[model samples]
Target chain A: MGIKRDISHTVWSVRGNAVMDVVTRSLEPLIAALRAAGYTVVGPTVKDRAIRLTEISSAAELPDGTGDVQEPGNYRLTERDDGMVFGYAASPDSAKRFTQPPRQTLIRSRGQVIEEVEPEAPRIALLGLRACDLAAIAVQDRVFLGGRHPDPAYRRRREALFLIAVNCAVPGGTCFCVSMGTGPKATAGFDLALTELAAPHRFLIETGSERGARIVAAIPHQAATGDDVAAADEVSRTAAGRMGRTVDTEGVQEWLPAAHDHPRWDDVASRCLACTNCTMACPTCFCSTVEDVTDLSGDVAERSERWDSCFTLDFSEVGGSPVRGSQRGRYRQWLTHKFATWYDQFGTSGCVGCGRCITWCPTGIDVTEELSAIRYGTEGPSCIR
Target chain B: MDARQTGRRPRLAVWKFASCDGCQLTLLDCEDELLSIAAEMEIAYFLEASSAPGPGPYDLSLVEGSITTPEDAERIRHVRRVSRRLVTIGACATAGGIQALRDFADVREFTSVVYARPEYIATLERSTPISANVPVDFELRGCPIDKRQLLEVITAFLADRRPVVPGHSVCVECKARGNVCVLVAHGTPCLGPVTQAGCGALCPAYNRGCYGCFGPAETTNSGALNAKLRALGMSDPDLVRVYRTFNATEEPFRRASEEAEGDA
Candidate 1:
């Protein structure tokens, strides 16, 4: 519904606004463009030793001159000498936090009369969001927007968003966007896409929407040469080369379920804390539960929807007992649904290969590693044990 | 009259045996929902709230803390007889509590270690759950039960339906809250995998590992967790000490602690 259908990655010239041609807008002006349009811009900010999406009014808030190092269960943000802006991988906070918050008040009731609670849909310009996260948001859209019962709340916040995608320049130690076919370069599903021309202190911006073009027109940007586009491609190519891990995308949907009986489940389960870190960190995991709270005077009662996890026993309680009574069973359900059954439900794979689960797991249980083990492990390992 | 026009509410009582009163405080902490609870049910015997005690035949009774003395043992039996529906709340009632550390060491030795007059004190050899002596209809996990969950438990009974407390690991809650794992990333030894879901994955969100306040989840893989802990440099003594914390005597942790110390 924004910037009327312009082709993906189409390079456009920023024309003069009401005044003269104000050629060449910098990173800070680009952020100002979003803020001027009554959009609250949010992007990766260095906070608490990690890059997280926080409210930003200018380019100074972005993790400039700082990059993060991530490995199996380890994440640390470090200072960079070259002062390169947008020189980092995905942060723990994503579009899901802003789109579907941890807690949402669903309904407030007083006996028979009940008032519905609508999600707060603020006009937000999301800057520096990565390619995998764009795909992850699409997956969320499928769950909340492309469903039979469209969640009004998710739909509201989602519609109010002005998505700005960033092509990956430096893949983290755990990133594998190449294998998932989700990133390293921006493909689709964004209003504006930016590629940081390596070490040049400049971003080659491409408009994917009319709103993006209008913003560019209102502000100022120099006409790009063919070398700028070529440089953008080269930058993305380098990022693709730097991927540390790879997801076996060769019919993962089929093999994951077919190998459901494989013993690797037990192998992973032993080291697996069943803490559900993977699901929580996942941009697409959308399970939630309803809580009914009555005020102290018993006059007003409220029903709130909170994020729920399949790993919890309370999630599958039936006839006074949880159906997934074991950690092994719960983990199997989570993985199988994410990798296998998700295709049947959403017409796509659930994982975008962002590597959050691996980086965040207390025991550092890697899903890709587990998948490989399941596909190639020896015979007869029971999850029940 | 549906108690709409009438002020009389359903009789409810809160009982404590041998705990820190953290669980009872959790109820008083429900400042917003307290009025709703008061409107629906009569506060028949919450010493934490009111001083006066009401007579028995209460509709519901919430018993906290573990049974520690002979008086506690007999008193709970009487409470069971009087209350129609009795639910045990928090670690102490559900599992034995931090005091259950006495389960590992000698109680007589403990008495001599602290008490001025060992002969004057009266105590049980083991700090046991309320269910050990009397029948408890439902058990809620957590050192101090989560308030919203407590509200759900009370309201569910009022509506005559089963409670919606899940028994999955703290991992799920961790994901729900979007907390990055402290254990995997920082090599912080955590019990989130085997610990039951609740507390909204609080510790992990704060960049710290879970201390297992809610006891073990439904099916705990202590063997695997132990192996990982060993790799992380936890000695035999560390393993024993880890399990012998808040819910020390809870079977899964107790058994794991016993196994860890059995060799050391």
Candidate 2:
């Protein structure tokens, strides 16, 4: 699924699809329906004092009446006045956790016998996925499935996924989905798109697939009026205005590669720990490395594919020495790959402006600000020399 | 016939100097896999397991702890000569352990205060790592080297390959495990950004900040992380104290701690 030109609810209404209005209480039934169809329903839930994507058996497990306060290197859960499901911004994790796992054994061998390990693709209905993450899933799809040699494990998991995208109402302090043109409203790539409205406490659902319609049909939902559509549009419009950050993407694809020697990289490198946090938290970054391990007897061996980051010195290792030895080169490679080189490789920018990288960074390094520094040549206050 | 086909197991020796013996205990803690490891190789000289000492010309020597005494310095050199490959295990052997904190201050004063007879104690002024005394083939990092990683090192030795220990930060392991950033989420002072990837990011996973047990990563910007920690209300003393734990004598942590002390 791709980002649609028009995000207005009227466009979806005009497409002859039923705009169904379901109450906050109907979420339990929606979850039940997904589970009844042989799916392990997963959604955002409060865990470790943060909203983490995990398997949720009931809708009550969702972080209702809860929001989040986020800044560079900071994130705190706050209690909201109204009990609204999907009240917070993007979770610390994204759809990638389900689509592309952190670790998967690809091959296993026992002495003379060798076997390729097939991935266990359980039908997972991902609920409360924001548009930024939906877009990230699309980027991953291009990375894993679009190319000539498609990753079989990624393919199996991707095919089994049932996406349920949520239109973000409460934008996090680090969110810049508006600037990226990827969020505030779930435009596409969802089986069912939901916009949670307050005061009346209802969800305006727009079914994107036949499977979504089938599930919604089973649940008790009313045919939404024009008022509901307008209300849903207003929620998205307000969220768009309240975006915590913005990136000027104009001509970024052309100039970022040429700015390799720019002093901003050295500036970022001084602050960048090369901790691999930004890449790990990033929704769209799909780099991985293979690991081979054998038992003590050397009889049983396994080759597994695990998530890797460009920040690691070993990631750029060639002939026993890393080409990007300095933190400056590593950080530059990551930033350039995300914003500029990604377009060349995958035909789209890597960043969805979800702000996970900003929030999760130990030093609070803002990617948007970094790009602005590169583009405008305005060096921000240096924290360290 | 090859060594494996001829049923000639390689001799493996375990050694200790000045440490808590926790790293040695990690080898013993491998309850299930210890038997398999024993079956694969000859457990020639592990005092922790058996009293019977084996002959020299050992295949591999897994040394634990630091060289606090002059005798240990001489012993490590002898160990290097006898063993085909000498792999130093844990923070003590690799980075001088927490005992290396004496490197910053006077050891004589401490001996006088603690010991009844300071004259009886014959110790070096500075507790140095095994690498400082002799040529080490590999240094397995951690406050107490992880059993899994220790096994991996042994496996690599048997396979005639280099051990696949990643030199990335604890943040990589923490993020891979899908744990929330304790430092970022709660403003907890963590060494995860600079600490080496090992122990599966134990502290952060349990909602506590990293203590740099595995020492600094291959490439670390502690100055940057220190700035962030300072912003989170960490004082100069706190920075010094935090960096001066477990693998305190490691270059990056040692330098950072010294800088913090200087700033203080």
Candidate 3:
């Protein structure tokens, strides 16, 4: 597939104009150009104590020189010494909300008249997407777009997206993309990838797609040199080094099934509030339930689809009973599926190794820790290797 | 007969066992989907939806809940005999549900906690999966199975092809949604790493941790997650409590709980 090609060495650097600096300066021009080209620019901006992807008319609206410090049940913003743009990672709100909104009108029916809701094509220029976010998008592509019954709305929106991926200059406390092999650098799946060079006000721009090439050509920037490439490489390496967490996925698929009868589930389940923040914060979760609403007249109604969590009792309602009645059953179902059985179904590990679940969980239940307990018996130390 | 080609409705029956009856409700919760599903299949026996139950050699039997009683065990045998194809739905039927918590504790003690007359309660020592006693054609994952996937399974079963329910972790769903890394963002405990991929990664999206409503994935390294939990400050008792949740009687969770209990 054209989607999976490696663009690791496709480095096209612009001299004197570091990618981040140029991105900051050219925000207005980029937005203007995209708008003129029939694209709506949406990127991360400070909102409700977190950086969220919202409509941006210019670069000034972006979160500049601000990064978030994340810990269990804690998230705070700190000012950066350097006035750098696109310095932070993904926000609490995932790009999935744009592609697969929390709630969507599927269809409307009135008496014998029936009409299907057609989603208007949205040409989106998503700015400052992290490599993990890009990997997440790829995962979603396999889910909604690659399935037998492709989600028309998701497919249309995805096809119209203009992605601007950025290599992480500074990793957050919870980031573990290095272990997941999803981030620190924008390896692929972007129209354009930007690497921020420190000293100079220039950017190292590399085009991953033809669309990226055109965008780079239109933007005002100088050609990048070997030094610029080295600077970008250093920035990526630093980001990778800063990751506070790691999960060894080596033979992970084989490991989970073998540990099926292991004794670690109970320990974790005890503290799990079953609030399901992890799934909500995850970048690749796509499970949802449909709802129908009718007016007082009871003649007109609309069917809507909304995001749902597996932690809830209603998520697995079958006959009149819940399959997983106890919190333990629910937790077991989730863990086993993520590590072991997913390979049987998707032919790929379901996890992209984003640490959203670890950070957002109210109880600080680390999946990596739980796996270690199961792999290395209870009497031993925490880390297996 | 080709149900799709000949327009002949496939006979469908819904069954239940020892559970909270939440999983079965997923079918009813599929309100709009249910109407369409009904149009495609003949509701041979669904006591929950209709009081008028029909006797049948059902083409497909969707069994929910779990067998926690001797009678239930015997009844499942009859159900398996009558149904051409039997699919276990929900965590209870596929993997003993919350009621299976009794498996660890004394049933008499449990009866004393809730019921006034311990003698009136007729229950088994442990709640077991349907597969333990009868052959199951398919086992849909989830505390309550994902309704969209549930519908897909039914559609595929009718179509006579393997259903495409991905057996990955909740983490996969989380990533696909582009959700911020919760573990990284909050350092909160979560089951997304080892949890199955269903419910569309809802808990994490809602700013909460995964509780593992879906059962174990194709392969799970729960031990690794347990070590992570300990490093995060979870006690052995805490670990035991975590495993003794819904589907606690399931082999993987059961073993994990026992280990935690042993340490405790």
Candidate 4:
């Protein structure tokens, strides 16, 4: 199922099929319809003082009336006066954590006989996904599925996914989805896209697929007028305009490759804690290592795939030496890979501008500011020296 | 066949000097992998887990703790001679552990502080890492080395290859877990950016700053971080205390602490 563009409430599929816009008073029926379709409804919920994307059974499970105040390394939940459903921006974790768990068992063996495990990808209806994350999922799809030997597990999970994209009503302090040209609006890669129009307390729904259309038709809904759809479009556009940061992606393709010798890298390394926090918080950064495990008896053994980061010296360990031995080298490697070399390999920029890397960086080391420093030769702070 | 019904298995031994025995406990914590490793190798000697001590000239030696006494200093040399590959495990064996904080103070004062008869308590003034006394082939870092990493080192020994261990900063792990930066957001003093990656950025996951249990990253930029900390309202004493924790004796942290003290 896919979503196509139209300022009007008409949504289209890949085959040029269109579905009319429908108005729903509350998000309660949508949740019920998704669950009734044998889908595990997963969305954002306030838990442990953070908006966590988890299994939600009803609208009450979502962070209703709650909004997030997010900045570089800061987040606080505030009560919204509007009581909007999609009040907050994206969480620290996108949809990647579930798709790629920190640890995943690959092979279970007894003695030398390796056994194949059963693949069970449940029907997961991902709700409240932002446009940047949609772009991230597309990138992950390319990395995990477009390869010669597709990760069978990731593929299984992808094939069973039912995407429900949400138009971001409010942009976070660190959001740069507008600069990335990825978000504020759910343009594509969704079976259904929603826009919350407050005050009237109604939702403008666009069914992007036949399944989405059927589901929308089943739920109690009224035909949306042109004004309602236009208001929905305005919400996403305003969110884009509200973004505080931007990455000059156009010049990064050229400047980053030539930036290997830039003194700015040394400057960044000085401030950089070399903590792997940025990569872990990133939605598209997919590096991993394998671990072997055996029971106490030594009879049963298993090899598990664990998430890894480039910050580790061993990530580049060879001949008892790490190629990127210095923080400068490592930081340069990471930023270059994300902005420059990724295009050389993937034909697209690696970062989605989700701003998780910025918000979660412990040091508040803004990637946008760092990239600008390297790009424009205005290395902001030489505080270390 | 040793124990696994295969060809001659590799010999493994465990040794301790001056430590909390935490790293030794980590080796035992490899409950699942321990049996598998035992099958592939001969558990020649591990005094904590087994009393059946094996002779030297062993294939792999996993040494824990630091050299505190003259006997420990001398005994490690013998261990180095017997073992083909000696891998130091944890902060004690790699960076002199928390006990190395005493290296900055008078050893006699410490002895007097603990012992009733000061003459009876014997220890070297400086509690040094295994590598300081003898050449170590590898160092598996951590207060207690990560069990999976320890397993990987052992497996690497058997396989005749270098273990894939990242010496990158703990920031990498924190990012990988998608946690918010405590330093930037809450102004929590974090050593993650300069500390070597291990323990999966655990402290930040629970909303606390890293204690640098894995030691400093390769060529740590504590200078920049110190400047940042000053901006965060961290007093000079707090900065000094930050650096003088578990792995205080490590070069980068030691240098940073000294600089902070100087500033104070």
What's model 3's overall lDDT? Answer: 0.73
Put down candidate 2 lDDT per residue, B1-264, tens digits, no spaces.
334656799889999889999999999999999999899889998998899999888888999999998888888888999998899999999989889989989999999999999999999999899989989899999988999899999999888777779999998889889899999887888898898987998998999999889999998899998999899899999999999987787888989998889999
CAPRI grade, predicted model 2? high
In candidate 2, the residue pairs with backbone N, CA or C atoms under 3 Å apart (3 or more residues apart, or in different chains) clash, namely none
Model 4 agreement with the true structure over B37-145: per-residue lDDT tens digits? 7888888989999888989778789999999999999999999999878999999999998889898899899889888999988789998999999999999999878
lDDT of 3 by residue, A1-385 (tens): 1233223223344333344323333556666776777888998888645787888888789888888776544566778878777777556665677677767789998876788999755788888888888888877777776647877788777767788877888776667788778888888777777776666554576676665666666767766556677888899988887886666667767777777566566666676656566777777777787766543233456778867767655578788567776666777777767666766766555666666676676556777667666666655454212
List the RMSD of every prediction in angstroms: 4.5, 3.6, 11.2, 4.7
Per-candidate iRMSD: 3.2, 0.7, 10.8, 4.1
Ranking by TM-score: 2, 1, 4, 3
- Model 3 spans > 4 angstroms off: A1-29, A46-61, A68-83, A89-126, A129-385, B1-7
Better-scoring candidate (lDDT), 2 or 3: 2
Candidate 1, residues B1-264, lDDT tens digits: the string is 333345557689999999999999999998987887887898899998899999988888999999989999999999999898899999999988888888878999999989999988899999999889898999998988999789888887776666768777887777566565566555678888889977888888888888999999876778777877887889999999888888898888989898899868
Model 4: per-residue Cα lDDT at residue A317: 74
Cα lDDT listed for each candidate: 0.79, 0.86, 0.73, 0.81
Q: Best candidate, DockQ-wise?
A: 2
Q: How far is candidate 1 from the true structure (C-alpha RMSD, Å)?
A: 4.5
Q: Clash totals for all models, in order?
A: 18, 0, 166, 34
**Candidate 1 residue-wise lDDT, A65-155, digit = tens:** 9988887677777788777777888787778887888888888988778988766889898888899988888888788767578777776
Report the alpha-carbon TM-score of model 4 versus the true structure: 0.85
